[model samples]
Target: MDFFEVINNRKTTNGPFDPRPISKEHQRILMESASRAPSHFNSQPWRFILIEDAKKRAAIADLAGRSMEKLIADGLFFERYRPYFRFSEKELEERGDGIHFDQLPGPLKPFAKQIMSPTGVEIMRRMGVPKMLGRDNRDLVAGSPLIMGVMLDKAEYIPGKLSGFYSIFGMGAAMENIWLTTHALGMGIQFISTPMEIPENWQQMIALLGVPDNLELMAVYRLGYVKEAQRRPSIDWSSRHRKRLSQYVFRDSCDTPESDDL
Candidate 1:
């Protein structure tokens, strides 16, 4: 498919992937395509770790289950509360982390709940992932037919602040590459970040991937041949166009022409 077409058609696949194995040549091609993704300062901070071992996949799934349990125990399963159940501003204030749950408009409540829920963890367990970390190991000690790992070099800034935020952007670029390459090769890929359940252990997860001390886990993707391609729901472009360009664009002065383009 053409590059632009691939971009337009690409969609996240959640159903079971084809159980067939992907070839090394194809894997290499996909990785190369992913590496072409743009990065800030050409830092090229992304790294990949692929998991193919059944046993290891199970272990990863177990970890995910435990993570979900932890979140549920902590009363962090926000998905349980829909718009039908509302919390007062005082209650939201007490649960503060700058997360103003009560302040979210009614229509956006479902989205807010998904963001704060342990959905990722639950999904991982449901998928039956095994290894906590590793790529394509047929044996306990050595190689496998296919599996890869992706990592990101950590920035020296605090999370969500300044340079640190760019790390995610760079990682996202690489991720896009991975998806495109895999799809073009007629293979499937799944990116898992739920294992990094405890944000505090983010560094530890990076270490497990054998990345440099300063690096962090960006994603863990699984690859395999897919028997059939999954279908994506059609998007409602009309809703996206609800707002006019003027709502977001601004001129130096209101008196100035919006622009010939406008």
Candidate 2:
């Protein structure tokens, strides 16, 4: 694929992926691309564990589902991420960022605008939305053909230290490489992030992955081949819109916003 095309097309797959397992050659390419990412003084701090075992995937999925259910049941998910919910096309166009909840199920369409409000939380609870979402999340993770765990070397990832920041920066670059490679390879990937939202659940993930003391598990993601006919989830969001250049960039000085037209 063209480089720009791949970059533009790269996205978090919010729906189910094709049921086929990813090829070993493609997996090698993904890891090699990650290895090529630049690191601070070549202190390659990132580590990855590729998981394809059915039992392990099911275990991780259970953690993710339980976390999502708990987060929604307590209304913490909305409280924590309210700022990033865009309800309408106009709001999305104005912000040019954040996920747009444009693909809600039929019953949810009426209360869509209130999704960030306490009243909406109550309504969703009454409607069993939390449980529904949890099931969806569980099935998505369990169905994925591959799950990857990303870790950082503890010696280089100390918080409040220069090496810490550099390690994280390098890790992001490495993951971005992997993300782009997935797009180029006709595969889709999504962060299995709900498990990390709850502290106990995160700990469970670390234990389940058998993460060693020398490394800190940072994130988990599911990957698989993508089919054009794949179905969307019960509820979904689109993050295709991006901020205009002027919204994010500054010119030569901080006082001047970069013109989007330029």
Candidate 3:
């Protein structure tokens, strides 16, 4: 596919990916392409750990489950993740950021919107609905054919300085390279976020993965062959998508916003 088409067509797949393993050649091509991303002062900080072992993936899922339990016990899961769920039909129609109710599974779409309100959450909890059900990501993390643990090389970045900030910026660029490359390859990928909600859970992942102490794990992404996407009922994502170009692209000067092709 052309670069522009690949960029616009890439989608985050949250459902079960095809169980077939991606080829090693394709994996290397993607990683090598990501590594070629420009970095500040040529400081390449991005590192990756590919988990192909079924047992290890299962272990990560177990860790995610524990984290979900902790988040609910602390009453922080639904509360902290409100930004991800669109609460009402109006918000879903208007907002460009975050996941919409229509993006959720058909059965959960109604309840998924309820996470937007505290009263809604409390009512669900009182009704014996498991809080973990709302945040469960074990299947996404473990069931995929490949899991990538992204890290930053501490030695490549200067601590407590502009270099640290630059490293983060560089990491994003690198990840974008990988993300776009995945779409170009006929594969799918999505970030695994549940484990990072708690410090202890992430720490356990670091230890279990045997990641070097000098590296900081920033993200986990699942990869596999593309499967048929499940679209929600009565929702047209093509028409109600991201923000307009005017909301971002500024002209030569901040005040003279529309002077050029914004």
Candidate maximizing TM-score:
2
Reference-based lDDT, each prediction: 0.51, 0.91, 0.73
Q: What is residue 179's positional error in candidate 3, in angstroms?
A: 0.6
lDDT of 3 by residue, 133-245 (tens): 43355655677889899888887666788878888899899988888888898887877666788887888889878998789888887888887774332212223357555
* Tens-digit lDDT string for candidate 1 (51-110): 666666555544444544454444343444333332445543343322233333344445
Off by over 4 Å in 2: 234-238
Poorest lDDT segment (10 consecutive residues) of candidate 2: 230-239
Cα lDDT of model 1 overall?
A: 0.51
Order the candidates by lDDT, highest first.
Answer: 2, 3, 1
Using TM-score as the measure, name the better of candidate 1 and candidate 3: 3
Ranking by TM-score: 2, 3, 1
Q: Cα-based RMSD of the predictions, in order?
A: 10.3, 1.2, 3.7
> If both were scored by TM-score, which would come out higher, candidate 2 or candidate 3?
2
Lowest summed lDDT across 10 adjacent residues in model 3 is found at: 231-240
> lDDT tens digits, residues 32-65, model 2?
9999999999999999999999999999999998
